[model samples]
Target chain A: MTPSKQEILSVAAECFMEQGYHATSIDDVARRLGATKGRVYHHYASKIDLFFDVHREGMARLFAAVEPARETEGDGATVLAAMLYAHALAVLENHTFESVVAQGVQMHRFGATTPGQRSTLDELIASRDHFEALFKNQAAIAKKDGSLADVDISIAVKTMLGGVQWSLIWYRPNVDSSARTRANLAKQMVRTLIDGVRTRAALQQDKPERRPSRAK
Target chain B: MTPSKQEILSVAAECFMEQGYHATSIDDVARRLGATKGRVYHHYASKIDLFFDVHREGMARLFAAVEPARETEGDGATVLAAMLYAHALAVLENHTFESVVAQGVQMHRFGATTPGQRSTLDELIASRDHFEALFKNQAAIAKKDGSLADVDISIAVKTMLGGVQWSLIWYRPNVDSSARTRANLAKQMVRTLIDGVRTRAALQQDKPERRPSRAK
Candidate 1:
């Protein structure tokens, strides 16, 4: 396929992801794209601009994947399952950008940014907050309904988020086995978290270590 | 007061934490301690040496505080409570080294290290794995007993670790309100994590946005 603007973003993301935001110069990104400095500048004003654009593109992809299902008629469990599935898939297929976003988030935290970067970061954060609110409310509704077991929605939300964020530590999507493993891992997390995996019913259905203690 | 070796490590940790490991020079640290380069180098052979020493010292303080109690005649919940308390105290007090350790660990993932740094990092990581295993076993035993509710031990362990690691982001020891606030936060995490927090439980038992959840 011809290198469109989206294609350029993809290539640039790889450079930023590999070399880090500050270390990656625009000249290198342009060269990687098989384009010149002027062409790169025409598309993106600065290195930081491309970095934020990549972040924006990433967040948009994430939100696009989950947002519709969240608005759908699915139950909380179904919706969370869909969300986790999409997230896990993204982690598997998009290792470089996924890792970049995680590290860039830390850099963004250190209060060392140009005004342009900060403004873009602010918008990115708000977008994330909006995304999180969707999950929180979904979990909250699940708690209210009998679909979910007893748990704090607030902390549960955090755990769910952390589970996704921290997985960048070990998630390698290039391998086929990794995809299934990650998908199962995420699905299992939802099941155990929302349904209480060690519930009396599950205990009764288990082996000794996995047995349920509450079923009379 | 005359600066002790402990004082030197403490001050060095602060500089490393604020300025980052590669970014900080020993001279900057010496200046902070009102000591000359000779004194600092005498205590620590090289910058890497100094960084590793502080890292080990912080880890030792952490393990020391939590080890005795876990080995004592306490159940997992009790032991975990002790560990969490110790952990929060460590983050609040040993801010510098923990920050450097966090940086060092991040650097490790990218192969950004000499052999000495990697070896020391391996040691630190092994110890951390040990702590994680300790918590995992504690949770497992607690789950088997009636002391803690049934949940995935892995999820709980990661969240507990994430909570402490994240404290490096917002934990400011000089702030008086946060001291009480964080202690309670740590305790609340312990409570809800091992045992499910009933909706009827005190609201103070849960904090807002434990780990960047989507709470609106």
Candidate 2:
């Protein structure tokens, strides 16, 4: 069966994440989709184009998750936590896309520029910076409200991102790891990151009535 | 002048990280070292051997950082902080090797099996688990002492690692970002991770006398 463009992009992302970009081909993605090269090419002009689209889609999903939280009428901690939880869930749900995006992001500095490279690279950077800016702004607010620890904004942002983004590499869909279970786990993970920035006074004021017990 | 085997390994790691494993050739490494392929082969049987050595060196550096903290006489919090600080410094100081190791680690499950694949894979997994276990043990101890938050150890450990390991991608040596500056930044980053897992009661009792002021 000829797969849809979306299907082709999804399969291509998984292939890119599984095998490095230089090693993967449009044929590999087509074969994974049970389609032909012509079908894959009908949508994406080239492998590079397809990879760029996958990256754009991943960024879009992340922005979709956090953008709403950015507009929410809540405290900085609440906003940051909401955005983080959404971002984590997005990463868990779209592991292949997220992983491919992450790999592309790191390799962005290394890859040789091709036709249309500059524009795409700039767009990618802008998308990423925009997403990160949300957290940075909230962190500023959190600090003003005296909810956050006296941590550098860059360190705080990167640390929070590292915790969530790394999930793409290690998290898997398991029998017992249901959607709800994963969501809760994501919340706990984000809590650790958010709490890292919480001031001592904030920590005292923001205790949850029900906390997960330590597994003995 | 012909470079030593140590220099070859170091240069090869940087190449592998910059150009990737498949795209990087042994000849490329030799050229980087102003040596011939024969000189490279004398120390490493092939590109695979060099890559493996790079990974081993990366793990050794990380273990070296954390192991001393484990032996020190300190509370769980102090020990965990020391280990994390050391780990972060190792990652920053050896960004190229750490980046290559991070790439290799994530790609290990995808690579084709070689003659000693099983044993090497087992060894890699064991080394990684052993390193992570130190954090887990400390978290367990911290819990027993009621100093840690009631979060899952697995989440806490991964969160902590994700923050530091991701630094390989974005961190750079700059004029203002001196060694002392980076060390202090690493400390702040670790504090966020450690604070995430610290109990509210512990948080109150453990406030540092000095805090980094918000960036103006």
> Highest DockQ, which number?
2
Off by over 4 Å in 1: A1-4, A11-19, A27-42, A72-95, A139-156, A172-177, A191-216, B1-4, B27-39, B69-96, B139-156, B167-177, B196-216
Q: Per-residue lDDT tens digits of candidate 1, residues B1-216?
A: 356889889998887776566567889988999988888888888888888888788777777766765765455455565666677566656666777766656656664677877888888878767877877887687676544444557865665565455556545556744666656655544443333222212111332212477658
Candidate 1 residue lDDT tens string, A1-216: 235778778988888765666567899888898888787788888888788788888777777767666665555555665665566556546666666665556566664787877888888777767877877887777666544335556555654555455555544455545656766656544443333323332233332432368887
> Between which residue pairs do clashes occur in model 1?
A132-B214, A133-B214, A203-A211, A203-A212
Task: Single out the weakest 10-residue window by summed lDDT for candidate 2 chain B.
Answer: B197-206
TM-score of chain B of each: 0.80, 0.85
Report iRMS values in order: 6.4, 4.7
| Top-TM-score structure, candidate number | 2
Weakest lDDT window of 10 consecutive positions for candidate 1 chain B: B200-209
lDDT of 2: 0.77
How high is the lDDT of residue B77 in model 2?
57
Determine which window of 10 residues in candidate 1 chain A has minimal summed lDDT.
Answer: A198-207
lDDT of 2 by residue, B68-159 (tens): 87765555555676788889888887788888887777667677667586578668768888888888888788666555656787887787
Q: In order, how many clashes per candidate?
A: 4, 1
